[model samples]
Target: MSWEQIIFYLFAALAVIFAFLTVTRRNAVHAALCLIFCFFFIAGTFVVLNAELLAAVQVLVYAGGVVGLMLYVIMLVRGEDASQVKQALGQKIIAAFISVLLVIQIGSIVYLSFAGKATGRLAQEMARYGNTESIGTLLYTKYIFPFEVASVLLLAAMVGAIVLAKNKLER
Candidate 1:
């Protein structure tokens, strides 16, 4: 295979490995760290796919913002409380079954795309204006309302969280 393909496979494998580790780790901090590594590798895969904007967002929004927030929350929890949170055997079995199905679905999608079945309006737009431009055009034109609604919802949630936390602090 070519260098780009090799690098893409490397990143993909590492991303999968770290993602699995993230779920399987007993320690919360280690799981968070594994999740960050998985995000970084996913970003690398995006870079390899020539989606630089997506790569940057993956690193900044997920690896930097979300994982950092998760780490801080993990630290705030007492060790015993965190350790006591456990899944029953039946839950673990169901989760593993669901995970296997999800993996199979993803693998099929990747196979089909690589086998050249991926084509449509989005592909045309991507080829025309490129990744970032096409994404921006679609986001602003087609999905503007939903985008704005999500932003407003997020803002409301943040305000609610702050109010609740402040009330708890006052007690």
Candidate 2:
């Protein structure tokens, strides 16, 4: 296999492993660290896919901004004790069933996508519009309203977080 393939698989494996650790780790801080590693590996995968803008955005938005905020919030909360809530046997069974269903669904989708025949015209059209410039142009021109809505949603989330963390009034 090529070096690119090797690197891609390495990053993919690391991303999956770190994602699993993020979910299963007992310590909250350790889980957060695992999530950071997962994000980093995902960014590496994006880089491998030749999507430089996406890779940078993944690192900046998810790894730097979101994870940094989460770490700060964790520290501010000062939650020393591990999670006390334990999953019941029924809940575990349900979770496992749901997970298996999701895995099957995703596998089917991926298999279908790769197994389908591709038209040369459609491939050419996609190539013309798949670049960062084309995507940015479409986002600004056609999807500007949705982009602004996302900004508003993020702003609302920030406000809600601040409000929730603030102390209660002395009334």
* Candidate 1 ranges with C-alpha deviation above 4 Å: 79-81, 84-90, 101-130, 167-171
Residue 5 displacement (Å), model 1: 1.7
Give me candidate 1's TM-score against the actual structure.
0.76
Best candidate according to TM-score: 2
Tens-digit lDDT track of model 1 for 1-171:
688778989999999999999888888899989999999999998877768789999999999999898888778764324655656889889988998999999999989778865223354546767888878988999999999999999999999978976735654
User: 55, model 1: CA deviation in Å?
Assistant: 0.9
Which candidate's lDDT is highest? 1
Per-residue lDDT tens digits for candidate 2, residues 101-125, read 9999999998888877532343345
* Backbone clash count, each prediction separately: 0, 0
Candidate 2: the clashing residue pairs are none
Score each candidate by Cα lDDT. Answer: 0.84, 0.82
